[model samples]
Structures are given as C-alpha cells and as structure tokens.
Target: MPAAINPPVVLVLGASGLLGRAVHHTLLESLPHGVVVVGTGHSRARGLIPCDVTDETTLREFLAAQAPRVVVNCVAERRPDVVEKEDAKARVLNVRLVEILAEESARLGFYLLHISTDYVFDGTKPPYKPGDDPHPLNAYGEQKLASEKVLRGEDSGERVRPGQGSREEKQGGWDKVWTEVLYGPSADLAESSVTLLARDVLAPLRSSQKKVDDWAARYATHTEDVARVVTAMVDRALTGAGELRGTFHYSSKERSQDLSREEGGEQRPGQGGGRAYTKYSISVLIGEVLGRATKHLEPEASPPEGAPRPQDCELDISALQEALGEEATRSRALRDGLREVLQALAANRMPPPPSSAARLRLLLAGLSARQKSLALPGAFNGLVARAVAHAGFEATYVSGAGVAAGMGLPDVGLAGLEDMTRVIRDVSACSGLPLLADADTGGEGGEGGVRRVVMEYQRAGAAALHVEDQVFPKRCGHLEGKELVPADEFALKVQAAARARDEGQVAGEEGGGNGGLMICARTDARSVVGVEEVIERAKRYVDAGADMIFPEGLCSGDEFLRVSQALKGYNGVNGGEGPYLLANMTEFGKTPLLSVRRMGALGYHATIFPMTLFRWAMRGVLEALEELREGGRVSKTALREGRLLTRQETYELLGYTPGRVWEYPNANAYSRRKGTRRSDFVQEGKEVMEEEDENEASGYGEENPKKK
Candidate 1:
C-alpha cells in the first residue's frame, strides 16, 4: 500500500527568489486540490507581498493570522562582499530574519524547514557530507554558516545567544528561545531586500538601459528544479512538528572554489571598504534574482520532466530519506536539483505581458505597409494573420490538411476541437490580424455541427472559422480519399455556422453568453462537381447569412480572377459577391513566403506562421543541451565578451533606479538617505513604544484591519 497522501498548508518565505520561486511552482503542481501553499516576500518580490519582509510586527501578525502547518524560509543575502563589509546586513538577513521567521511561525506550532547552501562549507573538503565541518572563506559562506549555527541553537530546545547585536538588544534574528513569549521590544536593524537588490543588480542593469539579455545568457541555475522539489516536500516536512531543529543544506552539486581564503580572486569583495563591498555583493544577488529567475514556467510537472544530474551545492539528505522513503531520497540527487532550478527559472521567466482591453495597437508599416491586394489559398498561421491586418490582402486561406500536417498528426480529422482551439489561441495571441481557422467538413460530432465548430473557434479568439461541406473523417483538402456529408446536412451545418459567426459577441465566463461565432461557409462542391453546382452551394450558404464564403480549389490565379469578376456581376448572395479570401503559406509546402506588398497584390487578406515559434524554441533548447553535454558545465560567460552587462548595464535601461548604479562608487552602501523604511515584515521586531501611531500601522490599508 502507498503512503496516504496528506499535505497541510506550507508558508514559503522569499517566494520570489530562484529557490523560493521554484519551491512555489513545485508545490502548486504536486499537491492535490485545496492543499494550501501561501507565499510571502516583499513588494519587490514582483507582486507576492504588498509589504517588506523586515517589518517584524506585520510579518509576525501575517504569519500568526495564517496559522500554517509549516514555514520554509528560502531567504538569504546571497551576496558575499556586502555581507563581508557591513556584516550587519548579512546578519540581518542570513542570521537575523530567520530567527524572526522561526519565532513568529512558532505561534501555531509551525515547524520550519529552511534552505542553506554548501557555501557554508569552505571547499576544504571534497563533497562535504551532512557532518562535515564548515570553514567558509567568503563573506557569503561565512554568514550562512554562522546563521545555520544560530538557527540550530546552543543545543536543541535551549536558550542561545542572539543571532544579531550585543546582549543589550535582547531580541532579533531566529535567536528567540522557543519557549519564550514573543511579544517583546528591542532596538531594531533595518534593511530591505529591495534596497539590497537595487544598488547591487537593478541599479547597474538600469544604467545600461535594462539590457539584461546579455547578463542572463551567462550564469544559469535550474530554478525550475528547486520549485518542483519544494512544491512536493513542503507539506510532508510540515506534517510532524515539535523539537524539530536544524539547518537543511540544499546545495549538493560538485564543489566549486577552494577552502583557502585567498582562492579565486574574481572580484575583490570589499574593494573600496564596506560601502563599495555592499554594492558588489548586492549586484550579484540581483542578477541571480531578476534575469534568469523570471522566465515563464507555463505549467510545472510532478518530479517534473528533464531533471539534470550532478547539479549545484550537494545537500545531505540521508536523514530526510530515512525519515521519508527512497522516492524522496532519489529526488535529492543532483539531477533532481537541476530540474528544479530549470523549472523555477522557466516559470519565473514569464514576463508580466500586456493582455486585455483595446488600445491603438502598434504596427510595423513599410514594404509591410498596409496596402490592399490579392490573396491565394492556404493561409494557416502567423504570416497569414500579418497579411490580413497590415498586408492589405482581401483574403487569406487556411487549409484543413495543412493544420493536421503541422501538428505531425494524421489529417483524417483526428485533430479534435480542443486541439484546434489551443493552436488557434496561440496564433491569435501572436497575431493581431484577422484569422480564418479551418473546420474540416463542419466537425467531428453531430447535429448542428457547424454551431459547435463556430462557437469554439470564436471563444478560441478567432475572427473567423471555415466549415466545409464534407463527410465525417473528411480527407484533407487538396488530397484524395475524401468523402462528403449529405448535401442537406452540410447545408444546415453551414447555416448554423454562419448564424453562429454573424452574432459577433464575446462570451461570458459561462459558455454562450455573448455575440456568437463568426462563420465562413466553405464549398468543397466546386472541385467535386461543376462550377454551376459550387456556385449554387455558395448562393445557399450566403442566404443562410454566412459571414464569408470559401470556395475550395479554383485551378489557377486566372480562375480566381475569373471568380472575382463573376462575383462582381452576380446578383444573389448578399448583393454582388466579393467574400473574404485566404491564402495559406507554410514552410516546405504550397505557397511560399511572400512580401506584404506581393500578398496585397495577390488579394490575400492574411497569412499564418504556426510552426515558426515552436521550431525556434526547440532548436534553442537542443543546442543549449548539446553545449552542456560537451562542455562538462554550463558556463555563465556570455557568448560575446565585454562586461556581460554587469548587473548595472541591465538596470540602466529601465531608468527606474536611485540616481545611478555606479554613482555612489559602491553599490551596496546605504549612501542615498537615512529614514529609509524597514521591510514591513520586520516592524514587529522593533521597539513598540518608540513608534509613532502612523508608524505602528500595518498593511496596504491602514484604515481596514486584516481579518484573523
């Protein structure tokens, strides 16, 4: 029998960092529905928390109110020189904030699981195990190791010296003795993750006008892998509480750097003293957080796919495995770690793009100038959409057979409505132009088939859908082995599709509460029978109120020319007929890539490029993977040299920094001003009496108290 799946609420601190973000993604995917995973971080966390992490009073209140089963802290300074300089900054985070988290989380018997790194162990030992003693050479390593000691305490369940400050301060860091009541005051230290990151990373990148692309290419960590693991383990670890005390060293990959203090002089940490040092340290942390960490995840997997073996900082999981099982143990390997890092980074990478609402819409006009002209058959993707809106083509074609071939699936109408919707959604998101999606012989199911097809395509964000008069499992257009639906049934389906399209409105959250789908009734009747029969079918469809008429397979451009001439002369079908015409242009297929000017001349209203993005994405991944395989390790160095944008260059472009990254001569020092606000989360740890009434207030709305 399997272990019964029981997961509780897990609170993740710094839920926006490479590691913390990864954990958030992982947990969301692994846990069953209703398993709570509340995330917290400063407003700078992108959007996770509305306040700062250093505000102890609010941080405590927030935790106490949530009353989660477990608290996992993935927060850290991550910068060496900054911590090395003012040391207090590092202590405040690496050591102090953790103490605060543990004490606050303890309110509801929350057991804590925090991530510490191998930097704690100086490279003196090869593959340091859980028991290996640490002797850190850098400021980052030293502070983390020190913080671990502070978290563990003098002995489990006993009073220990404070993580920060002299004996006089009395309260700060995770140093609170577990048994003591936490409602106390002390002189507080103040520093926010935002400030640290700004001077170090954002400031510099902004200087370069926010050109981080170069910076990101170098130094990649698999944040995705971390997200998967934490997302999976948080609840399990939180299940059992009481007497749980210790630091969990997460970095388990092969070692880097030497134990000797003077090794790897890449950059002098405290170059111009403490102030300069702080800047340098913060800069590195910023790169780690912003650039690669924010990649889009899409959706995460369980023990997510493509895990790499032998990754960063090897973690000792013998105890965890013993306590849990082999599955958990196996997941602790390097590959698992890499997968987590990758997934997290990918998830985080998704840019907060613009969506919804209408605007003037930006367009590229030139040879792509919006000029009206002619269109050929076969418009299925990106090129088509571009042609429709900006290329000035009268109509673009979408072929049913082409759609199937693009997916690498059989064209025998095997592609379902859902599949079509997905592809169309992506195309629509990419293409702002009008679209004419293929509905291949109406649809798969039955009566009112055209209604079903039209409804779905409209919801899929399509401007139009084409329904052909063909039988079930209709063969590809322009291909043999095709059959036809009863002419009458086909006629009804076309009417339904047309009615669906003509309605023209968006649906409510509930299905079918808006303007109906736009329908383009297609006639396969032309090629099968004579021109007269096809013409008759077209007339009937028009009578049924089709938004447009698609007559498949005309022989040549002259035939098209003849039809357009005839339509102008005809009297029936919605007055003289010049319906929308589509031309599908696919790679290695029928039509070739045509310039917008040429497409306009051809009378094509639009074109589509469905496979362009997928092809590019796949190629990039494979090349990167191959490079990793051949080179032993993925290098952080950019393909081209020259400062690799150095955190500052990337920041400079944004024009959203404090003066400039290099202006202070040191990125880390608190040179700008005094009176800077402490992270809202840490305000609880401050002396209450000293605070003004306004200072004591918490959260976004001071007037509205948070509900417990």
Candidate 2:
C-alpha cells in the first residue's frame, strides 16, 4: 500500500485580529477539503496557534516545521496613533515581519499573500492605482510603504521579489494586496475605528454633544470583504487557474465625501454624492439607529489631533476586479455593514429602523389594505413632522400651501423646487416617516422640470410627490380662475416624471426599490373642466404612469365617490390595475371636510388635511401675540399649566434629552450665554396657575363634539 499523503498546509499569520480572523474563517470555508488550514497569533485565543511572527528566529522555525504551501501575512500594527507612539516596536511587526516572511517564503517555497494599507498614498489624489506614486503622511504609512519596497526588491540587491529582477535574482513567490479602512465583527469596540467611534465616543454622550472630524475622507471597507478577496486568490492559485503574483488593490466604493471635483473643497451641509457618509455623518447615522438625537453632535471641519491622516485615499480596485471578476470585488454598503456591527454590539436588542425603500413599501401596503383611509396631516416644518409621527399617524404630507405659508409666501406657485425640497428633507429626516410632497405645477421648465422634481424629491427623502395639471403661477386647487394645461401636455409631464422615477430606481438612487418614488398626478380639472372630464383625465394620467390619482377641488363626497368608482372600474394602460385614489379634505376648500372613515367609505385610499396643523399652529401664534400685546406680558398661565409645549416636552419631541449642556449659544437666542441649561428658563416661570384637566391642557384625549 502507498504511504498516506499529507494535505497541503495553508498558514495564516496574526489570525486573532479582526482581519486575520476573517481571513482564517474564509479560507476554511472556501478551500477544498484536501487543504490543511492553520492560524497562528501572538496569543492563543479563538483556537489560533500561539506564535510571535515579529521574531525572525521563531517565525522561520515555525514556517520550516509547517512547510505550508501557501502563507497569508495579516500581521500589522494598524492603529495610526499607536504606531505613532511606538514607532520602533510597530516597525518590527509592520515592516520587519514582512522582510523575514519574504526571505523564509523563498527558502520554504511557499506563495506569500501579504495585506497592505491605503495609507501608502498621500490621499490628495484619490482612486489610487497599484502603480501610483506613494507619499505616506505619517509613521504608520511610512512603515507599510517600506514593507512594500521589501516585497518589490527595492530594499536590497540580495533580496528577491515577485515580478521583478532577473530570473536568477527572483526567489520568493508572492502577491501584495492594498486595502483601506476596515471594520467588522471583533472582540471589542477598540478593535475597529468605526465601532470605537460608535460605542466608545458617541454612545456615552446621549445627553451631551460631541464633535467629530469631518475633514479627512476615507473609504470604510469591511474586513470580511478583504478576506474574501484573499480567499479567492488562494483558491485560484491552488487550482492552477492563475498565479497571484502582482500588486493589487481592493477597497470599498463607500466613500466619506463623494463630491465631484467641481464641487470644490467645501461641502455644503446635507450635500454630497448620494449616501456617502463622513465620520461625523457616521456618528449621526449611529445615533439614528440608537434612537438618540444627533442634533448636538457637531462636525469639526479641521483636521483631528494625533497622527496625520491623508485627506482621501480611495483605492482603485480595477486590478483585483480584472483578476477575480466583478462579483469578487463587490463591497457591502456602509449602512448595511454598520447595521451588522451595531447588531453584534447590541446583542441583537435593537433591529435596524426601516429604510426609505421599506417606508415606501409600507405606504404602498397601507394604500392596498383598504381597511381605512390614511390620514395625512400636512407638516410645514420638521417639528410638525415629529408631532405627526408621535401622534401615531402612518405617514405625513408636505403641503404646498403649508410650506409657502411657513416661508411667508402665498400658495400661487411662488415656492420653487428648492423651497419644497428643503422642507421635504427636514420632514423626512425628523419624522423618519414616508412623506408625500406637493410639486406645484411641476415648476417652470416643462418636462425637464418635472423630471428634476422627481429626482430631487426622491433625494430629499420624499417617498412620493404629486405634480399638478394647473398652469404656472397656479391658484390653489380650491380657488377659482385656475387654468389647466392641455391634457396631452400634462400627460407628457407625467410620463417624464414616471421615466425619471424608473431611471432613479435603476441607478440605485435614494429611496429606490420596487415601489420607488410614487408619482401622483393631481388633476385640477375638476373645477377647470367637469366631473366627467376629471375621470377621463384621471384615466389618461394612469396611462401616463401615475402610480396614484389625486382628484382636487371635488365639491362633495358624492363627486369623490363618483371619481373613485369610475377610476377603479376603468382599465387603462396599466394592465387593469386600478390607480390608488386620493381625496382633498382641506379646510375652507371646495371639498367638504370628510373624516378618514368617510373618505374610506367613499373608496378613497387617502385623504389629506393639507393645512390643518398649519392653520391650528398659526391661530395659536396669533392668539399668543395678541395676549402679549394687550397685557404687556406673555401668559404665564399657559406655560405653567402645560397648555404650551414645555421645554421637556419639546426636547422629547425632537428626540433630545433635556438638562444636558447646550453648546451652541445661537441655538437659543433667549439664552444669556453658552452652556446654559434648558431648565434655567423654566425656573423663571414657576408661578402657580389654575391647571385645566389633562385632556384640555395637553390638547389630546377627548374628540371635539362639534366635529362629530
């Protein structure tokens, strides 16, 4: 009988660290059963073999004994601050360890796969290729660069390197992989920069504000992704498909600041290449996931202290893609990866909140259920949006009239796309609820304008928006003298909006999913033409790809029922699928003030109280000013009796905890100085007043008998 053959050994160095553990596990899962995988670390934990690779004598002895066919070098002192503090000791592990490994690989005849960093580049010029000139800015980068030189035969004449020197000079078989900032499941928060920021820095400051660096841009890549790249290369080499012998780059496309070169150095607040998050932005997202307010978490525009970092070191992974194909080089999205880290940290106590896509799907589900007509109160500002969410409503609306009134403008199409989108962003961010915005007449530029509205509204976080058929400088839907665009012209605009929505979904733009941004066509034709004309135009709009129909200025519940019954029965271009119907229940409008139940009874999927909260809020403002003017003092009674929103209530509504130190002096113009407590003002208005019943004081609980 022939002697039993031993399996080819694959050794992993530094297998206890975040990236090392990922590589070890990936190799175990990816390699064939014939391969023997062994992982060694400085410490014996997680079943990793204990060996200090920095010591050349011990490393050589271990490698000789194992006689591994392939060796993956994951050993590095990754933290910049720690590397900066102990340069000599860090150099032993980061640079010298690789030198020894290269020499040993030449002797042992093993293929060496070495992991490097994006820090080798200065970061001023980005999307760095493997052949790009490196200008390391700090000690950590300098050491990693030195290691690369050692592997490339630039360090000494005697040392051998891959893809370089004469055949006689070439000794070791090797490949170098360059990667960027890494984060993944680890033993502790300190193991990764992302988790450290979230758990150590941001989580403890629930009531206080913390400033984070937003200047240095980074591509936060997952370690598991890098590990998979290593695994793929190993598999290819083992199968003789190809040799992994050249310098390659592997990094995530998720960037910190994805602004175009033309956008210049300064980034305006809330503007960037879509969904790219900076460190400050990452903190804000973590706060959102934790249900904490990041209002106080400010962005420091300057560079951070300790260890100089490159501005942007985004790696170009084309080489890896060419070698391993596109699927092997693909990266997980930043938010999705962060969610996994957070879930591990929280022990799965907190599930990720609904994404924009999920919220849009929820809205579509609600519309389809037909159990009740969704009550959508108009939110003119972010605070109002918060109140709407807190009131247990399914969703909210950004009414054109309400937004115009809030901006001190009339509702005759004076407010443009920017004005409506500004409020849409605020409402969506604050409420985290699906929003329906009013795009009045789709602005001034015709079909292009309609497309812009769809794209911008989707970016601004609106789940849906309605474009009206009324002409430019249009009157409110309830007002007289409103002129309608030609039915064909309006249908063209609707088609443009629908096409833009489809394009955005395909491009993976914000709020993109199967439902996408719902395009509702609002026909002001009820007043301009007739009820029959309204129904006919509704069918045309449905054919034009409007997801829903908004019949404006219907004078009675009967007209609403008539339109709903007609549209529901008519089979249009949408393959017999009936469009969701919306009814306007604006105050002082041509339509009667129909209750939610009554709207559902009339077969409408939704009913909008376009100016309800705005009207109520303005009335309170007027009454308060009048009382102050007549009495020469504000009503202490209102404050003491909780008739107005108290400071605590206001903070709670804004997702903030009160009694913390307020850092921004300009945040409250009423405050005398910086760091003033919120309770300081409440202490001044402590005079006792006659308190009303809880329902009356809080303006909740009992329903109004007059409405009934």
Which predicted model would earn the best TM-score?
Answer: 2
Candidate 2 whole-model C-alpha lDDT, 0 to 1:
0.73
Q: Residue by residue across 568-644, what tens digits does model 1's lDDT show?
A: 32343322223444433445433345554454455443444434444554577677788789887656653454423
Computed on alpha carbons, the lDDT of every model, listed in order, comes to 0.44, 0.73
User: Which one is best on lDDT?
Assistant: 2
Which 10 successive residues of model 2 have the least lDDT summed? 663-672
Clashes of each: 131, 0
